[model samples]
Target: MFKAIATAAFASALLLGASTANAMIINGNFEDTATLDPTGLVNGNKLSNLATTGSSWDVFTQINGWTTASGAGIEVQTNRTLRSVDAHSGQHYIELDSHPRPNSNSSMEQEVALDAGKYELSFWFSPRNDDASSNGIEYSISDDLVSGFITGPSVSPLTSVGAWTLVKALFVVETAGNYTLAFAATGKQNTLGGFIDTVNITAVPIPAAGLLLPAGVALLGFASRRRKRA
Candidate 1:
């Protein structure tokens, strides 16, 4: 009986340790709490804290487990709506000037780090209108802001001028550390605009010993009683 109890306790401890270890925030809210802001924000937009250099935007904050940011130049009123349960956000429309000669490229960007592993990154975004050929946004990721960068899970070309769209991308972190995430406005240069929201990066949870130990001990005792009867 004692051996069974001990075994159960040990198993429980292992499971608990695993759960506590795995459930962590690679990067929680973008308060710029860390002095490393690889992804700069738009000036005048709301920001939680200044990125690295103590420079902050005026368009982002943690409102009920969500971060919001927007970048709209002098043209038509535009903004980006972003929210995340873990640590992700998005936006809506950002109208840039005409294309080619008068192209208006208004955008916002962020940087985060992760351990080398398989991750599923997803976000909800939309352009001024659902016109992939004419209006949309482009996103890219790089190991370093200077070099060694990989493309996105899938660069979504704006096609539907709907209310909001959900886009997903899968990527592996070859090296753990900081990486730059860039969001750009793509398509015709005239009156360019868009929005992004609810971005999240989630990894599989490890098992928790606390949850397992009790079960193991109970099983062990049942086995021992049966053995004595036999």
Candidate 2:
């Protein structure tokens, strides 16, 4: 009976200690100012704003220019941010004559360097167009250069475009160090109306073996104290 109780107590102590490990934020707030940003986007990542129709996607001169909007839904809370770009309605993007509609032919992405470990990544999504289209968002993670279609999470393809919605996915890192993350939204050429917002990634805390050793010693001390009292 003593052995069983001690084992249970030690296990509980270990669990408690492990849960206390600090989960470091490797990449946050899409603050990386880089050249050729969107071209390096991950499989799923983006941010945008909404205020009725006819407005195009916002683009900040620099990532430092990003800020949160007021009275937005929870999905738009963190992972995604606002921008004023060429997003538009009526099968046309960017009021400029050269840009096409539906913004489907276009994609947006950003990059960040992150430490390795388990992580919970989530973001808000909303279609800029109410038209019948298969517009959807996707996220990708990579250790090498942010190129090609890196695998991660994605909103269901063939979606009901238009209106706002939140999407999230979890990923684990096998090794530690610098990596590239991207988000892309694509559709038929000249389709128009696509937007993304509030991209966020949080590291999942991993239990450390070293943390358990002290707890084990504490458990042994408690057991010894109980014996003396008895």
Candidate 3:
């Protein structure tokens, strides 16, 4: 029992010494504006306000941690434009329709370097318009490049207009490598809806080895403590 107490103490000490996480994938919250400017998108270049069915919106190809996979570019909006809907979290959010007007049918993705483990993808989704068909979005996490389709995550927008719904999907990475996490507009592709925000991907809780590592350290520390006490 004494040794067990010592182990626990040692483990706690080690945890305290550990530094904060240094993980892959940035701008998960879409708040990293040092790269893209949102103000330039005022009523952005849209054909129908896109948000309102008869307005226009601008498309900015540069988002901090995301890349445009299709369509004209990525459409970002503020409360000042379109549906005038507030973001799910920060001051900005994404609309997948993008530019080229009518129905850009856009796709935006971010590449992440991850190790072999279970990871979960999460985001808040909402519809720009009441039309359910136009609000569809299909999220996929596939192997980096190589045109592979890995069905994962359901972040499709709901019908409540500005009512954002949280969506999550869990998937496994067989081997450590770069992977593509993408979101594309589905259904009608009317360039009017499908809003995404607070996008995040994180490795699931550590597997068995994770627990064993700290336990191993604890055992060593307990042994050393025992020798000292003796």
lDDT tens digits, residues 5-123, model 3?
24343553353343224366577766666665443343444322333433334566667788789876787765546443566665567888765566588888888897876555656
CA lDDT of every candidate: 0.36, 0.33, 0.57
On TM-score, the stronger of 1 and 2 is 1
Q: What's the TM for model 3? A: 0.65
Q: How are the candidates ranked when ordered by TM-score, highest leading? A: 3, 1, 2
Off by over 4 Å in 3: 1-22, 36-57, 82-84, 144-159, 206-230
Candidate 3 local Cα displacement, residue 71, angstroms = 0.6
lDDT of 2 by residue, 161-205 (tens): 322333434455656765555554444334343444444555535
Poorest lDDT segment (10 consecutive residues) of candidate 3: 218-227
Better of 1 and 3 by TM-score: 3
Better of 2 and 3 by TM-score: 3
lDDT of candidate 3 at residue 15, scale 0 to 100: 39
